[model samples]
Target: MVRLNCVLLIDDDEPTNYLNEKLIREAGCADTVVTKESGEEGLEYLVSCAEGNIALPDLIFLDINMPAMNGWEFLEEYRKLDESIQSQVLLIMLSTSLNPDDHKRAEEMQEVAGFIHKPFTTITLEEILEDYFKSNGN
Candidate 1:
């Protein structure tokens, strides 16, 4: 089995985080699902991981709306990081918003791996992984 390296879920909603974490684990999509309540916290976690020489997460699930920093803010911060550190990460924006602008913005971002609707299911996760691996020629 191809083990998922890591998954970082940055969402302010505690319930959403809980459900997604559980679902991701149950699907065997990843060995660990690390979560943060805000974009700043998530960025801090990533920076700390890099500084500690820990294996960076393979995938990131970012939420658009939050208290302090939103998903867009996180991506901006991520861009300022050292290229070597940033290069090792893949980001996917997850949101409940149906705004077309959000979709357009995500698509515009070169670093954004993709966008996923809220309440991610096993099938969605599978399709995401399959498409991701296939596109990367894994």
Candidate 2:
């Protein structure tokens, strides 16, 4: 498997973040895995990277439900960022929501690489990597 430079996980739940981070590490998915408790904090990290002239994470796993800024709200704000800053990143939705509407909404967004159900498994991560990164000759 190709190891990514970094990955970001944005979720309000502490356990979710911990588990997801552990899963990614065990799977050897990336060199760095960053966990943020809220969408606002995730955005701040991204902005800081841009300001400091640093590379952004290769993938961002965003949760749908958050306290202040929801995933959708964060996405809207993300769109306002420079294209260069977002060019190499794949933004995927990671949620426990069983609502089909959420899935559909994710599909409608061009920036969304995929929507993953919560409690992420290694198999799901493998598929995402294969489908998005490998297939595209990354």
Candidate 3:
């Protein structure tokens, strides 16, 4: 498997983040897994990495429902970021919402590469990793 440089989990739920981090680490899908409690914080972290001349996460798992800035709002701001930075990070919408509209909205967003239901598992991570590497020809 081609391990990613970093993976970012942007969700408000602490338990979900903990479990996702553990699953990613156990699966060895990425060298670094970062969890942000909110979209705003996640955006800040990304911007900080760019400002500090640090590598950004190769994949991002974003939640739809957040307190201040929701996933859609984050994507709006994300689009305004430097093109170089935007091109490198792949965004995936990870949400528990069963709303078809949410899924449709995610699919409509150019930044969203994929969408998956929450409670992430190692198998899901593996599939995502495989698809990503295969698609990128890595």
Error of 1 at 4 (Å): 1.0
| lDDT of the structure predicted as candidate 1 | 0.87
Superposition TM-score, candidate 3 onto the true structure: 0.95
User: lDDT for each of the candidates?
Assistant: 0.87, 0.91, 0.91
Residue 57 in model 3: shift from native, Å? Answer: 0.2
Model 3 accuracy (lDDT, Cα): 0.91
> Which should have the higher TM-score, number 1 or number 3?
3
Please give, for residues 1-138, the per-residue lDDT of candidate 3 as tens digits. Answer: 778899999999999999999999988768999999998999999999999989999999999999989999999999999989989898999999999999999999889999999778778788888887766654
lDDT value, residue 127 of candidate 3: 84
Query: TM-score of the candidate numbered 2?
Result: 0.95
Query: Who is ahead in TM-score, 1 or 2?
Result: 2
TM-score of each: 0.93, 0.95, 0.95
lDDT of 3 at 8: 95
After TM-score superposition, what is the CA distance of residue 116 in candidate 1 from its true location, in Å?
1.6
